[model samples]
Target: MDQTVSTVIDEDVCIGCGMCVKVCPVGTISMKEGRAAVTGKWSLNCGHCEAVCPVDAVRVMSLDKEQSAFGTFDADHRWLPHGEYDTVQLVRLMSSRRSCRNFKDEPVDRPLLEDLVKIGVTAPSGTNSQRWSFTILPTRHAVIGLAEKVGGFYLRLNRLAEKSWLRFLLRMVGKRDLEDYYHTYYEYVEEGLMEWKQKGRDRLFHGAHAAIVLGSKPGATLPKEDALLAAQNMLLAAHAMGLGTCLIGMAVEAMKRDRSIARFLGIPDKEQTFAIIALGLPDEEYQSTAGRKLVVPRYFEG
Candidate 1:
């Protein structure tokens, strides 16, 4: 992790309120001679100091201002204070955003796709190591290209799963992943692959016009969790933008097993792909939000 301090404080404009110093996680900013100053040699570059400053006297040089500028919608640069947003509307959006399998043939605009990536990076990352990466297949043709590679992987996997001897040998070595996959997903995958190859049906992406592959470069504290969090942000944002999205776990699984799929998508060898989002104008609609499964909360009393 590069901890180089990128925080610059305009001393003349600073009110010396110490808000930036108080909010900085790495204590990079401190009050010196009744004014806020960059006193530390290192920083997380998380922009806490810049965000908390009273008079906009602080700026993190490493952070890009263009990232917050959305092409599809006007973004409010002012930060919403705690407890300011409506929770009811927030929860409504959360519950209403369903996994859409049916999508229209109309392709998503490149600007909208770019805006989605911008929305994706707004998610918090572990230790401020914002190593999340996005690879956009901006057209149906591009999406189909990736789908074909992923389909090939599943086809080969089905052949191996057909071999009882290999499955048994793997299970004997305490590796039950193949055996579990064979039992749980073999039949479904076989049917889907056949439909795809013979009838030109798309069971993988469900005919999505576009896709965004989310991943993380090496050295993040929690790469997978960070990528998933960013994925959730993009999913919800897509829903609000009049688009539907689905998490293609099978594509992610295929990529994990075969590195060539990632390479085909132009993702580097060092990065790990975590989520692939299939998105486009939805063809389906629901009347209302549905309830989830019951759950009991467990409190740990120490």
Candidate 2:
């Protein structure tokens, strides 16, 4: 990649503690006599050298100085004081989170939505590349418009899936890769969507006060994974704020397939919504947690 790493050592400020060498995940830093130096031919560019320096003697040329972590380890500005007790509380909070479909008509305040987005964007990303973007559909009308477009797209797909002759024609025309989506649309048309329509409710968004569309740039490495992490973070934070959240996988899929729906959401042509979270005050409540089958991990010891 022709990327050169510039490492500078302050001879006078260095205490020869060798802390930087020990903390470096990649073996890029080495002790030359009494001072530290970059001995490796290539750097992973993880920025551990600068983080471990006791006296700030090392500087990575490729790193942005403004974005670098500030403050000492003992008094790090980013450290939060919660520990095991907080972990238990967090677990309880997550266990109580429900995928709320029924929402009160009250709108989520702009300040709360802003706070949720702020927490969401702070989620960890590959190489610290926070490329996630969010589009907040705050009004009922806007959210309904998006839901209608996605529902229409699915309805059209359902027609082709329902007719035997049309399905055969579609397969012959080099479009036989939609079996899974076709099934989903078929079920939606048969029962799931009709139930909502009978109750005069929005089938897609479930009459949520607002919907947050989480997206990332097309072709980005780990885009789906990154967006999922951010969505989870937003969910937990929303629950904490006395709000409900539901991940709308159907709407996300429709957005990916239909460019018109994507444009309606104001998402860029090259960007895609990996996930959508509907947020609002809950219309229903649960007194206790429900039981479900658990899948335990298979651990390996080497």
RMSD to the hidden true structure, all candidates: 1.0, 5.0
Give the alpha carbon lDDT tens digit for every residue of 1-302 in model 2: 22245666677788888987887756677888887777876665656677777687877776664343322112233436456257778888988888998999988887677677777866777654567889998877778888888878877777767787776787788887565556655875656556656776676787898989998875446788889999999999788889898999888888888888989888889887899998889898998878769989999998
Instruction: Count clashes in each candidate, considering only residues at least 3 apart in sequence or on different chains.
Output: 0, 0
Candidate 2 TM-score over all chains jointly = 0.76
How would you encode candidate 1's per-residue C-alpha lDDT over 113-186 as one tens digit per residue? 99999999999999989989899999999999999999999889999999999999998999998899999999
CA lDDT, candidate 1, residue 101: 88
Candidate that would win on TM-score? 1
lDDT of each: 0.93, 0.77
TM-score of 1: 0.98
Which numbered prediction scores highest in lDDT against the true structure? Answer: 1
Clashes of 1: 0
Residue 41 deviation, candidate 1, in Å? Answer: 1.6
